[model samples]
Target: MNNYNTIVIGGGPAGLACAVKLHKNNVSCLIIEREQYLGGILKQCIHDGFGLQRFKEKLSGPEYAERFVNEVFELNIPFIVNAFVVSIEKKDGYTINVSTVEGIKTYTCENLVLATGCRERTSKQVEIHGSRPKGVYTAGAVQHLVNVDGVIPCKKCVILGSGDIGLIMARRLTLEGVKVEAVYEIMPNPSGLKRNIYQCLVDYDIPLYLSHTVKRTIGYPNLEAVEVMEVDEKLKPIEGTEKIIECDCLIVSVGLIPENELAGRIGVLSDARAKGARCDLDFETNVEHVYTCGNATHVNDLVDYVSESGEVVADAIRDRNDSERKLIDIEVKGRCAYLVPEMIDVNKKNNKRVMYFRSNKILKNATVTMKVDDKEILRRVYANLRPPEMERIVVDYPELSENSKVVFEIEEAK
Candidate 1:
């Protein structure tokens, strides 16, 4: 049995950040990573844009990982590489049974941080009817091939899904001398960051077909062409709008789903909307002492946010001595998709609290009003807000009375 003060079940930015923060406070932790090396998906992402908020400088994915890896190494934090945690069971008094190499390993710890991250939704998940061709690959898979394995999947590519990965891949393939025919998005607006759309697609002269989708892929051994079509507001295909684009490869970047198998195995409560474990303000799950962060909690587009979440978990673990932690549930109704840390406990030591949430619809020049039992407590106006971009709001802790229910609502600003 491998015993530690805490166990972090991932080696990505979130996991590493949590380990580093815990280690700084003299808390011993073991980070178990399934990959041969640390960094997780960040290792395969070679493009820059990460670390802008975290480090105040733009860095490539690997570079960002290296910074955290070096920090962990400096702290002498031990990690198990190539060890997949199949299941986790809370034993007597918080010991975790982490199934890994050398059989079922048990770690006695006061806390467990889950940073398992997320997985890209594949073509199979979307059930896109098409020829099973060799040239079709997920944008992340192709990214791994080109950036990690140093192999380009194809010369001519038609990318489906204008999400961040697809947009970035479009630019990446173009830089590799590959002909990127076009990028198709089912939504009217590109599902990626506005900056990415401008820099990766528009600047690269790649055509972005919004409200469009790939109807069918045509090819045998490799991709040859894709039948693209426009869609109505309801996303139903519009007749007579089918157009074929000849390409040697098709890369799908549909979306990402939080990897929550381990979370489910432990019987942790999860929100179907977030598709991740439901966490409290301390990042703790329904199961006491088990905390979740990063993409494992929700798909965060920026690494900075992941690190921020790590810090939250670390703070909670460090401040567990506080017995006055009071549970406060945050309800998102009316135009809100969901909120992170579905619940929170106000720390009596501090009267300020931060909350993160995303809306179900895009709002331009709108105000977000937060209330407790129908009484307006806080309100903030923003120039623009989208569901894809997570937003943070702060509330006065003193305003939260005992048994008070808080609700968040979005309204157009005058």
Candidate 2:
């Protein structure tokens, strides 16, 4: 059996960042990754637009991941690659069962950080009626084939969903001399960032059809074409709007869900709306001595935020001690989709706590208000709020007395 101060599951950008911070602080940490290499999903994300916020320069996914990987090496943080953590349960601290080639091994840690990241939603999840075809692939799979494996999966393709991955893949296919027929999005607003919409679709002159969706894919052994349909405000397909677009490949990039299998095994309560573990201000889950960060906490729009979250968790882990938390549940109003760190540890000494959230519907000139026990504490005005773009806000808990309650509401600017 091996032991450490903290054992981080999954060696992606988040896990690596956490380990690096802990190592710098002279904390013993181990990172367990199932993949053969570090970097996680960034390995296949060959397109640029990353590291703009973190590095203040445009970098591809691999480049940005390399920065963290290099730091991990410099710090001499130990990591086990190609080792999958199969089970985890409480044992004094926590016992992690890892499945390795040599054999299953056991490791114990005082605290655990889950940075399992996220997984792409497949065609089945989106409920596209079609037979299994060879040409159908997720945006990530296509990206790996094209960038990592050096093989273009398609010469002509129809992309479903306007998320960043799908949009980037559209541009990538276009640059590879492949004909990108169009990108279909069921929602009225594009799911990707505004800049991505412009640079990837509009800048490249690739057609993007809003309020549209893929009805079905027709093919025997491979994809021959995709039937497109317009969706109503409810996102239900409208009859008589079916348009068959002939394409060899159909890449689906609907959405990403936080991978919380490990958390679930340890009885960590997950927030259905956020699709992640319910965490406090310190990013610790309801489960004792267990914490979650990065995409496992929530699906972040930027990978840099993922790294930042890792550092936050690592710092929190450094000061962790068994103590009763003064927890306060956060409530939302006025089209608020969801909020990360669903609760605040009022007992925590940290005055300023970073919180992230999104609005359910498009809001223009809105004001976000935070009230403690029915009294206004924090209020910020925004020009606009969209579900696709997440907003990070800091709330100060300076004047909290006994029986304090925190609630958030978004009101359109008058």
Candidate 3:
């Protein structure tokens, strides 16, 4: 059994960033990746606009990932690709069982970092009733087919959701000479980034129908058409609003689910709202020494933020000690969708805390307030807030005790 100081799983942007930082700090760490390549989803993301936050330049997905991949290689950081983690055991520290082309191998580490990214929501997950067809695909599947394999899988397509990936594919398919019939979103507003709505859909002259959903897919062996219907505010389809549109493909880009099966297996406490692990200011889960970052923590809007979380994990582990953590709950209320680092570790040396949050619904002139007991600690106002865009903030850790009351609220301004 090979042992190390820390073991970071998933070679995506998060894991790559964590490993690079660990190596720079002279910490022994190893990266285990399931894919043959190390870039994760970025491998097929040929579109530009990534790395603007980290590199201060517009770069393609592969280009941004390549910078970190090159750094990991140049640093000689140990890593194994095409390696899948089968099981994990936590006794004193942690034991990981990985299955690779060679064979099953065991490794041990004092600290574990999960940067497993996320899984795309498929048509089945969204309950789109229809016959099982060949042309129905997730936005990611179509992306890989076109960008990675150079195969145009469809001539005409009806996208079921206005997610970022779906919006991007509308443009991607159009560039490939495939006709994108329209993008149907169940929500009243687009679920993707504002820029994507303009660049991917508006720029391509693609039609976007809000408050609409694909009620059913009509096709034989391959997708031939779909039944789209208007939905009420509650997202229930209207009876007589169904309309048929002929197409060869139905792409679903509803949303992404955090890949947290491993974390669940180990009995880590999860945040229902975040749909991920419940962590503190250090990104350390309820289970001591076990940490999570990136999309594994929550689906992030930007790849740069994912990498930023990896850096947080590295710093957390580097500064970690045997001192007991004083974890206090951060109660979230009001119009916010969710917040990460749900707890505060007042005992940790690092005082600067990074937090991420999203609005539950669209709001203009909204105010966010953070209060400790009856006294307000932080307050910020936003001109506009949308569920599709996540907000990040950095604030100093406030004085906290075991009984200290911490509350975060989002209120819309009149």
Candidate 4:
């Protein structure tokens, strides 16, 4: 088709859920996915623990994704698989040029949803001085190799980041008859969830070395070992704490960066904190009809939140107002790492304003407060707050003018 009411440029869980919701709203939407399949990264995630929030069941990643994929299929939503979006232009509405099996095809849409997801941090990005070798791979790449291709990449591996993927891979490699020596993290705190650390490392009897980092990779054509070092609180390496661990493979799962290159092409303002598009409560970017959701918005820890973001964007597009978007910044003060929907559109009287935020550091008995013009409107006390676990909040914020100051503050209890 040459046109659609909305075009979602990803066939992952976010795009799939977005299309399903859009279809339910009687909106004609089309999905374009670069991968041959619709499941995105979930395809390689074979372990369970997904869908706890959304489905209320412990389902595997594929299972969670399959639910939405089936809905899209049953709803008869239009989708093009293995289609890469070559370029996007905002001529009349939005023009999307996609490269498909048939040929280059052009499609137009009134609204565009970017669900391109996130990319893993590589060895080079983390400044791991190493020679290019076959054994070094990202956690996601190792996942695909083992799960999809049924090929075990290595016999002995040392994971260089206690990220969720690295922790999970530590256990996964063990199950696949590979020896996982240890997981090293540069930060004092684990980068992943507490459950992941317990289930993947603690339960698996794998040790996690905190405040430690891989200093150098001692590998040649294939692989060999890595030199590790301990770091101080400021993350500066301690001189004499260096040690070398022998392992055939090095799995790098330091972190993920949101895929916002497409958003950048359309003059969308970027948020350095969120590492994505600067969006309002409705998930709409500065550019009128362009929207961003899922990991394209930020690296969400759970798949459920990714799907939730998609639904939010779908509903926003359905109930869009013609009134000018009077956007006001939701200033973050103290302890908050970042907050999604950093701005709120006062003109849109959407009672249910959903937001996601994370703590800058671990805090016990933390108090989170929302205020407008120094008038505290909402305040909630959390018994414990951790940086890895993201907190979601829904507020029916009071009506405000364009100049009203909206701020969210977090403070540790005395």
List TM-scores for all candidates, in order: 0.94, 0.97, 0.98, 0.98
Candidate 1 backbone overlaps, count: 0
Q: Candidate 4 residues 1-27, lDDT tens each?
A: 689999999988888889999999999
Off by over 4 Å in 3: none
Model 4 deviation from the true structure expressed as Cα RMSD, one decimal place: 1.0
- Cand. 1 Cα-lDDT: 0.84
Q: Give the runs in model 1 whose Cα sits over 4 Å from its true position.
A: 94-104, 322-328, 346-350, 399-402
**Minimal lDDT window, size 10, model 2:** 397-406
Q: Which pairs of residues clash in candidate 4, taking residues 3 or more apart in a chain or in different chains? A: none
What order do candidates take by TM-score, descending? Answer: 4, 3, 2, 1
Ranking by lDDT: 3, 4, 2, 1
Per-residue CA lDDT of model 2 for 1-414, tens digit only, reads 399989999988889888999898778999999999999888888888888888999998899999989998887888999999999989879999999998998999999999999999999899798888889999989988889889998889999999989999899889999999999999998998888899899999999999999999999799999999999999999999999999999999999999998899889989977999999888989886788999998999888888988888988988876677776688878778898889777667757888899988788989899888888889888888988898998878665543777788988766
Q: Which parts of model 2 are misplaced by more than 4 Å?
A: 399-402
Model 3 poorest 10 in a row by lDDT: 345-354
Candidate 3 steric clashes:
0
Candidate 4 residue runs with Cα over 4 Å from true position: none
C-alpha-based local distance difference test score of model 2: 0.89
lDDT of 4: 0.91
